[model samples]
Target: MTSPLSGIRVLEIGDRIATAYCGKLLRDAGADVVMVEPPAGHRLRRYRPAGVPPSAGDSPFFSFLSGGKRSISSPTVPPELVDSADIVILGSTPAEAADLGLDVDEIACRTSVITVSNFGWSGPWIDVPATEFTLQAWCGSTGSRGEPERPPIAVGGDLGEFIAGSYAAFFALAAHRGGGPFDMSVLEAMTTSMQVFSWLRKELMLLEVLGRSTEVPSVERAKDGYVGISMATGQQWQDFCAMVECPDLADVPELRFQVGRWEQRDLIRARTADFFATHTVAEIVELAALFRIPMTAIGNGETLSSMDHFIERESFLSHPSGFRAPRAPWRMSATPPLPPALPPALGDTDSPWTPRESRAERTGLPLDGVRIVDLTAFWAGPTATHLLGMLGADVVKIESVQRPDGMRFAGGFREDVERWWEYSWVFHGVNSGKRSITLDLGSEEGRALFGRMVAEADVVVENFTPRVMENFGLSYDELRGFNEQIIEVRMPGFGLDGPWRDRVGFAMTMEQLAGLAWLTGYPDGLPTAPRGACDPLAGVHAAFLTLAALEHRRRTGQGQLVELPMIDVVLNASALQVIERDVAGVLLTRRGNRGHEFAVQNVYACAGDDQWIAVSVRDNDDWHALKAVLRQPVWAHDLIYAEDTADLIDGHLADWCKDQPRDETVSAFLAAGIPAAPVVQPPDVIDNAALQARGFFQTLDHPLCGPLPYPRPPVTGHFVNSAAPLLGQDNAQILGSSLGLTAQDLARLEDDKVIGSWPLGL
Candidate 1:
């Protein structure tokens, strides 16, 4: 089957995770992408597991990123190839990119292009090094995450950068069809990624002014487990009290009122927790449905993976590489994309053209010439843009002098011991492909200049606090006045209107208010936050939304507001969990890494201290396997009908599992047709043989961060390909000539603080 984006060509250069993933999306849509890799490949190639066999001569990163596209050696690629490319992706400092003769202005004169960078080309820290963790910290994500006392933990799995890149891809495609070239900002991308937090912060500010509660009710602990109950309306509150069989409590004059309960929140929470402890997980979930309160169980990666919906929907696609990767969040019907066979080996194919499709014709390209202008920061917003970029949009990231996005200043402002891009690993992960150009949009002249750029852009994406845009007179109204056809995405913590419009927040805080954090810890312990759950969850939603909006624009000439509130998106994404609460009024509590609905389930210790096995039995058939593994019919019999089956099962299973070898148990379960998985470490995930068998990991001989490993595209469709991009490495060709900028003019822009060079220092 032909792909939706067939007949599109994308040229990706530089090191950015978002751009790379975005390129993969385009390839999936059947785009013919010429991924121009540096002499040593890219940084993503060096991301290896603890004990996996490293990439030999070729890059292992390809197993994840290079599935359907053609690979080309960057420094050695023929110049004609550059000129023939339809869209060029760049993500380097302005000066470094110009040195390589791939600047956006230069390429724009010859063909369409997109520029992506840490800050837009004009920012003060344009040349600073960066990583995803640093950016999360600087953007207030760390400050609000975890216990609020521990140092901020980076979100797991480089998700922040991935999100930024996803959004970049989304807009780039629209821009390509709309016009010529554009620029996207990484900072803006990150900010948009935190839509909910940004909105909440704004709301809190307004609340402070109004002299209302500045914070949501704080939850320190719960009896049954941590939980969050949101009864926004008076009737809902009344219903909730009744559902818990505590109607008497509601009759108390002070308790009867929502405002009053909030004032005495501590007492109410304690009372609520005590009530919840009496009920089981099932009972609470069912009862919440009866009362129509918004409630959900606290879950983790395991829960997300094991959801029946995801399994039935085939949200995860098995690869030749081993591990099953997730599918793209959004699915399209018209031009359904197919997943590729596997990631590419470094220079896996000898030529740019496969026998099936020649480079000269550029067949199989999904998005032929889409373009995007990215102005965002953090995770959510940038993630959406990156997805778009991956699908064959020319994504350009914009930046300014104010604080550069945090990712750009990672690694203590110094190069790593190896002098590689290690410190900037996070930056490279998110901002690949596209071009880089600096434009200080905060100044009057800069804003005017941006207005001109907007005239030529298809989509403008940002995640600034609502005030930032207004302060610079670059609000939606002002932007639309410049170009009504442009798609503008305004992502705040809360929506534009609300009582708490200016509250300060981040993913951690959002998780708490939205009830996620409250439900994640132990049943009797404080709430716990995941390493980086918010970024990926919010990013996936943003990506889904942006793509849907793009399709809407394609069908209609009108371009309207795309408002994604982080809190709202999270709430919606978690609707499955909350629906029961909203309908039944049963309060939810934390289960502490445990699952429900399975008579047999647990994470049991294995031969090693850290090694463990997660196994589950849904019916009698699996129970038989459990019996076989335990080799104890009497113990199994006791569990099946004992009055205290849970205790019996725990005791026997604990002893049995503690002495068993993890691999041996896993094998026995697989052999017996029981559902089991290892409680994997990062290294375990990175090195799983199953993943390798599925051709999941990609190998690349990166110039910096040497021989990195990257995971394959999570989703595979009917038509799919995966390709990553380089840094602002495509600037010269994109901005210098393609945008009609003269060499003299380009030189002047460089001197006038409009665009700076790459790798500025340390």
Candidate 2:
């Protein structure tokens, strides 16, 4: 099948995995991408897996990323290729990009330039070097990781770069469709992908939206392995209690609410934890499925290859070298995605394409003038539309009065207030800048009215299980009937056609099933994750495919269906872990605060209460510099020159850090040229000095929630001044005024239970 980007030509001159992955996505979509590698080749080519053969030329990880792309070993980009290229991706600082002859101003107006860097284009630290850990630390989302008392740890497997690469692909296609060149900060991308904007801004502390835990017994031990469970609503909680056969908790009114359950967690855990410990993983999995609960066993890299779902879904592709690699994270109808293939060797396919005229840039935000019908409820679906809305798309969020977006009551429930749902900062943060209108699909009038809205919309996005849309008679076929060029994007937990498609899975399920959770946490402990990463991972990926579909429609006047499975995205993000089992003949587990690239990486306690700092001695230079700063004794230095001094140095470093303030210590590390950052608390994340100076958070005013700081779009410059709409706030404005419905017609419909601003019974 021909891809949406089959005819496009792309030139990739990037350094980070983010850029390579972006180009790889373009290539996977059938674009002709020519990778310009340094004479020594990309760093990934030499990135050997732990305990694996150290043959630099046969890197399985590099092949996983660069697969199916043509590679040329060249000192510089071919001039003719620049003009012929539809896009040029550069993963470097502005100065370095200029040195590589990829200066934005110097490039032709037609060739879209995409730049992804550790900091960003104009930031003070843009030119400074940064490791993956440094970027993860700066993003603020890592604040919620690890035990609350322990120093925060970076999520393993370079998740920040994985997210950045996903967002870069989204922006790349946006730029191709006259959205203009973009400079994306990997830090912002990581934060955004983790839904820090929705969580940190509202002070939910972290991503508790969708189905991961904030105030629940989320991670628990099974007889053989660990499992993650999430119950976002009261029904789910009661169901959980029933499944555990906890008579005291089952059908209990107080336990129905999260806050009440949290307050009585000791009692709940006593009953639940015992049940978990006594059951095997298989027994628990079966029980959870029988109860239709959103739970799954936590599988690590080694276990993932053995999953029944993995085999049934054909999640891996066997390479020519007899190793396996993950397939694409998403799929689409009309134009299916290409399978993973071995990457080209150096100097292979060095041939250049003929010169072509560049397309002109469009004005305003990337998605300007596009209208989206958003039917998403929780984090993943709302997040995708949230990003599109930020890009200037007119997003109309469709919810029903009987059952609005579950996120409205996600964080809390104030029984005293009549309009308590309107005050949810979590809902406001995720749904910002989108219009809301109520319509009961169960009613004929509501369905008819929705069909009209669909006719005027360019895209319809939903996170419902595959059957919900078809049950509503508003599937892709129905949407296409309303508007032949309407892009239908589905965010399913498993996928549209997988054997587990109908199973109730959430981000927690994905994190465990995809092997990411297995790679997190301390080496000796059970797997945990950077809470609900699969939400935004799938969110941004959905947006990327939606953009691709839009571009395809622009060219061929046809809109198709795109399926973004939350688990697949989690699996793909854990690709770095996936390759290890294939190459090293062993699975890599969590290493706590330890790092792979650096000589010494760990966290140390500071003087203040629960305060800490993370420092990495990249090499001997940083180690020597740290010792000089600490004024270590001559005897200590005489003990060793370069033979396993990391642990010894770390012990001494811990003593020195205990007496110093965290921020002060961080400054000292930075001054001494060491990679370091504070493990920021949730409140401190909002007040991060660097983020404040960069204007990362801009204030947006909501009627009920008042003025609040909203994080800017990951790639866009800043946020629009609009706010998340009150439930059904746009009904009168849209139905009566815009959709040509008479006032009398609206009133009659409201009286007939066809529409409402609040839940009918409430």
Candidate 3:
């Protein structure tokens, strides 16, 4: 199959991983991406990934990032390449861009320009340096990590930059039609995960906002290694209880819901641990499979490299020295992404640039005329469609009157409240900017009406387990009969045909399977499960592929089926760790609040309750600046650069911060241009001065929820400027006007329970 982006061209100018990863994504999608590296080499060449052996030369991390892209040895970008590019990715701050001899505004006039950086374009910290640890700390997710008495932990690897890079690709394609300059911030992309959900939940219900106290996703000691498990919904918990032979836990009234179960986590943890300890990993897997529990064995790098599922699916690819990586997170039927080639050597040559037909001048949004029929629920799929809606696609969400989105009743059913289905803040938060309409897909009349809508729809999206689509008789082939030009996006937990395709998997299960859980937490071998970032990662991956499919349709007048398995999303995010082990004999383990890239990164206790501040000394300059801030000079300046001195600096920062208040300590560090932030709580996120200054929040007025502010995802565009619709808010307009159904026809459908505004049997 031909690559979807076969004719598009991209010029990537930056040494940062965010830039390199952006180029890689475009290249993977089949764009001709030319990477500009300095004559000596990119800065990434100076270091190798952690745990990589000495024989792994020239940065295996860089090689994985620059895969499939031709590299030119140059101090400055070639003017011809920039002029002929459809997209130019500038992964630097304004000051650095000036040093690169690139004009952002001038180049944006001809092609789309996406600037990816750690901070914002016009901010006090714009030119300041940042690390993954510091960015995660500033985003507030790190604030809630680890023990309350000890320092918080950073999710290992350059995962933050990878996320920013992925967002950059989405921004690039999203702005293709609309020629413009766009800015993507690494911190902003992370905030859309733990931080946004943390604060948004507090704003809605004032519940347990962050994962500070309770741990729903906890790791237990299996006979061989460990297993990570979570019960996201009530049903999963019941099945888990039954499978473990603790049927008593299932019958407890308080344990019926996830929120309630969280209150008694210690008791539940003890019971599950006892069960897990008695069983081997294989035995636990058998039990989980028997009862369809959402759990998985916590695999390490070596285990991940040889998983039967991965081997069967051909999920991994490698270069020389056994340096490993996963394939692209998506697959298309007609125009599958080309398998990426190994990283190019410095000064490698490719064919001369030939620009394809330029897109028409976009009047407003890039996806102004596009229409999407959304059939997704829960976190990942809703995240994808919500982002698409923000890019100006007219997204019409479909839910059955009798069987609506499961998210509509997140806290479980309530007998007292009359309209319990409309009370989920999670549904409102994730599904914003789309019109909702109810229809019973179980009925024949409703299926026929859905077929008619498919005939006029540009794309159809869903996230059911594999059999649901086939059972509904609405697979891509079936939808093609309605409209041959329709693009269908499927987000299964696993791919369509894998042996594990039908396995009951959720966000946490995929995380365990990806082995990222093995690399998180403190220096201890036990896993500190992440806050289910995989789901949102899946969402971002899905949205990117949908646009690629749309571009394919624009080029070949062909619509294809695309798959974004959640497993692939997490694996791709955690790819570096797996590759590190592949290239080395040792496994990459966790170190709390510190990384191999930094000399000093720690969270110090402050004056208030649970108050703390994150500190990262990036390099020699930062180390000196930190010393100057503290008015403490080291007698041996020459020896200060050594790794042993990092321990001293960490101790010094802790002592200095322990006596002072968090605000004052953070202020001192920031004024000195050091990367430091207060470990902000969930409630404080709503009024964060930095996000407020960036205008990151938009107010959407809802009849029931009032005019509340919602954090916009990290992208520059005209998002849908409305709140989430009521269950079937647009039923009348869509059915009566668009479908040419008479008032009597609509009344009859509503009476027959085929269509309605609210739940049928509520």
- Scored against the true structure, residue 128 in model 2 reaches a CA lDDT of 55
Candidate ranking (TM-score, best to worst): 3, 2, 1
User: What lDDT score goes with residue 493 in model 2?
Assistant: 91
Of candidates 2 and 1, the better by lDDT: 2
Model 2 score (lDDT)? 0.76
TM-score of 3: 0.94
How far is each candidate from the true structure, as Cα RMSD in Å? 18.3, 3.0, 2.4
Give me the candidate number with maximum lDDT.
3
lDDT of 2 by residue, 233-334 (tens): 767887787888886686667777665676577788788887998898788878888888888878766777667777888877786655776778778887
For residues 650-710, write the lDDT of model 1, one tens digit per residue. Answer: 6677688788888787767767766665544232233434334433345544444444444
Clash number for every model?
230, 0, 0
Q: Which model is ahead, 2 or 3, in terms of TM-score?
A: 3
Kindly indicate the candidate among 1 and 2 with the higher TM-score. 2
Off by over 4 Å in 2: 51-53, 76-79, 108-110, 198-215, 250-265, 349-351, 415-417, 632-645
Candidate 1 vs 3: which has more lDDT: 3
Q: Where does candidate 2 have its weakest 10-residue lDDT segment? A: 204-213
